[model samples]
Every structure is written in structure tokens, then in C-alpha cells.
Target: MPVDSCHFRTKPIHRNTLNPMWNEHFQFTVHFEEMCFLRFAVVENNSSQTTAQRTLPLKALKPGYRHVQLRTQHNESLEVSSLFIYSHRTEEGPAGGATASSLVRFIQVCCF
Candidate 1:
């Protein structure tokens, strides 16, 4: 799967396996989660031909491990497992403290 114009990519898993374990960690610096989306593609490793692709909204996702049922271009169903974690850093003052008002103002300025 790729996100944000191919800026992030997960390691490929083996083909024809009932259960594949990637055990990989991917980190992304997300500024606008509302506008961000995830693109999944199932491509042939050797031929490089895309067999299936799907786009999903980021904000609609929930945290923790889950199963994603994807649809191919031909509208066939495919199941995949995934884990999602979302985190953001809060801006701190010179004294290294973040106030509630400051965080609210930051969200208003950025999200609105």
C-alpha cells in the first residue's frame, strides 16, 4: 500500500500465502489527515501488473488492528489485515509547556 502520492510504501509480502506477516513499522508525518487517503494495490511482482487497487479515506479509519475487505477493479472482494496508529505532536512554549488554549487555537487555525 502507498499513501500521499507514493511518499510512503509498505514492504511487499509473499504471494500465494494464506497468511503473510510483514512485521514492519511505517511512520508518516501527516499534516492534513482529513485530506489524506490510503491507496492499496495488488501487483504482480514479476510482471509489475496491477491486479487490484482501492482508495480509502484516512479519517474514516479507526485505530488498532482490523481487517480490510478491498474490491478489485473488476469488483471482486479481497481481504487484508492492517494495523493503524495515529499520533501528533503538540507545540510547546519556550518553557516546554503546552496550554489547553494554545492547543485549541492551534487546532482551530490548522483544521478550520
Candidate 2:
């Protein structure tokens, strides 16, 4: 994702032992609008002696879309990102970014 000119290239975390709250993942390897899958490993980093892993595979999620949110069981968040098919060329989604006032107005209009 592009953030303040830091254009990033995302890659799937093949084996990461993350908090239980993290479910969704972003797959950025495939060509834009193409299908890809998520593969992950849940690990506990605090333990010093041993290696542990929990595999979470993507069975059936819609293609051309990615939604990832990393959060801890305590509701603490680490990171979040997503990519989706709007056009074949990579671009930001509609309403992807907005000011607080604009978002509030949008919410109001949608609700009203």
C-alpha cells in the first residue's frame, strides 16, 4: 500500500505466529485482479526455547480481494491492510482514504 510516498510491495507471511485475533490476510503476489491465496503460521514469540507453528490456510475466499487485520486477544492492534480489484492497474479503492469530516458526512448520508 502507498503511504506518504512509501510505496510498498506486500508479501504473504508464510509462517507467522501471531495473536489469535488475527484472521484475515492480504495476498499480493498474483497479478492485479488475479486469484491468490493466503497462507500463515501462528507463532508464540515469547518462548525462548522452542519453535511452534499453527497453520491457517485460505480455503475459500473470493479472489481479487484481500483484507487483513492483526490484533491481539487484548484488542490491541498491530497492523492492518488490504488490496482489491478496482481496475487491472493497481489503484486505491473508492473511499479508501478520506478526512474525518468527509467520512462523517458519508456515514450520515448513508444512514439517513
Candidate 3:
């Protein structure tokens, strides 16, 4: 079976009772029944790794994005099960850049 689309999300797994001022970290859990694919720094699965998810200054995360890629057991890019998602880190997380990013994809039906 070929790879399909995956899901993404970011949730703060913490309690308010604790001091909010303390540094808060984001722990991402990715699961794929088939194998692993690329994790992106952008919505279109672009960019490389970041500080493993952490609290950054407003300017640094001004236009923050994440990407990830999962490698199959055989370490083949084709045998990829991929998932991607993107969200504005904050209200002023930079938007409307006029120059829109490009995207490329090819949907596979099946093998003959």
C-alpha cells in the first residue's frame, strides 16, 4: 500500500496551577502505521528542523513553521507515509506576504 495523508496538531500539555512564567515546551508525537515521512517547517512540508519545539521570541517565531519526514524501514523516500500541518504561532505571526509560496504534488491511484 502506498502512503497517504497524515494529521497534525499542537496542544499544551500543562496545568495552569503551575507558574505560567516558567518555560513551556511543545512535545510533538507523530505516529505512522506504515513508516515515517518528512516533518516540515512549512505547510507544504518544507524547511529543516528547529530547536526541537521550544519557546522563542516573538520576532523569531514571527513566521514560524515546522516540517518533518518519515523514513521507511528500508530508508526510501518513495516508501513515505506523510503528514503535515501549520498554524500561526501568535496573532501577529506574520501574514499576507504578497508573495505566496508554491506547492507541488502528484496523487497516485494504484499500480497496474
Candidate 4:
């Protein structure tokens, strides 16, 4: 997904099993959390077309792990998987820096 026109991506993990684990981490510097929305897409490695996609608001997200029911663009049920999200704000910082007073939201979407 691209945040504010800047693309950020994670490396794809290939496994023979049905359940593949990727213990990875991604970090981003966000300017406006309230105005931000997440766009998630799942595409086949051999194809350019997206099989599943979702655009979600940052404020609607919650911390910790939970199951997210995915749907295609047609609104049909796609899959149900686990997701984990975490957010942190600093108490003191320079101007324009993230602080507790200033609003900042974090969202993590992981499919299991």
C-alpha cells in the first residue's frame, strides 16, 4: 500500500505450507494520521491483477490482534484472518514532531 503517494512494501514470503509466517516489521513517518487511510491489496505473484483489496480509515482501527474478514471489490466474503495493530506517541518533541498532544494513529494489518 502507498501512504501519501509514497509506496511502502514488505518482502513476500514463499512457503509450501498453507500457513506461512513472516516475522517482519515496517515503519513509516506519517504527517497527518487523521487524514490517512490504508489501502490493502492481495495479488497473485504471477499476475498483476489484485484478488482482494480494502481501504480502511485509520480511526476505525484498534490495537492488538483480531480477525479481519476480508472481501473482494464485489463485496463477497474472501477470507477471515488475524490482524495486529499498535500505536505510540511521544510526550515531548520538536515542532511538527509526534507528541501525545498531537494526534497520531498507527495501524497494522496482517493476514493469517
Candidate with the greatest TM-score versus the true structure: 4
Residue lDDT tens for model 2, 35-60 = 22333222334542223221122234
Range of the 10 consecutive residues with the lowest summed lDDT in candidate 2: 103-112
Per residue, candidate 1 scores C-alpha lDDT tens digits across 36-61 of 67665656666878776666676665
Off by over 4 Å in 4: 1-3, 79-112
Deviation from native of the Cα of residue 45 in model 2, angstroms? 1.0
Model 3: lDDT equals 0.28
Write one digit per residue (lDDT tens) for candidate 3, span 1-112: 1332444433332555222122323322222212333232211123433312222222222223332243433344523333232323211112544222221122111100
After superposition, the stretches of candidate 3 with alpha carbons farther than 4 Å from their true spots are: 1-25, 28-63, 85-112
lDDT of 4 by residue, 20-81 (tens): 45455544455566677766666566676766666667556554554455568675776653
TM-score for each of the candidates: 0.57, 0.21, 0.18, 0.63
The alpha-carbon deviation from the true structure for residue 82 of candidate 2, after best TM-score superposition, in angstroms, is 20
Q: What is each predicted model's overall lDDT from 0 to 1?
A: 0.48, 0.28, 0.28, 0.53
**Pairs with steric clashes in candidate 1:** none
Please tell me which predicted candidate would have the highest lDDT against the true structure: 4
TM-score of 3: 0.18
**What RMSD does model 3 have?**
17.8
C-alpha positional error of residue 88 in candidate 2 after TM-score superposition, expressed in Å: 14
What's model 2's overall lDDT? Answer: 0.28
Q: What's the ranking of the predictions by TM-score, best on top?
A: 4, 1, 2, 3
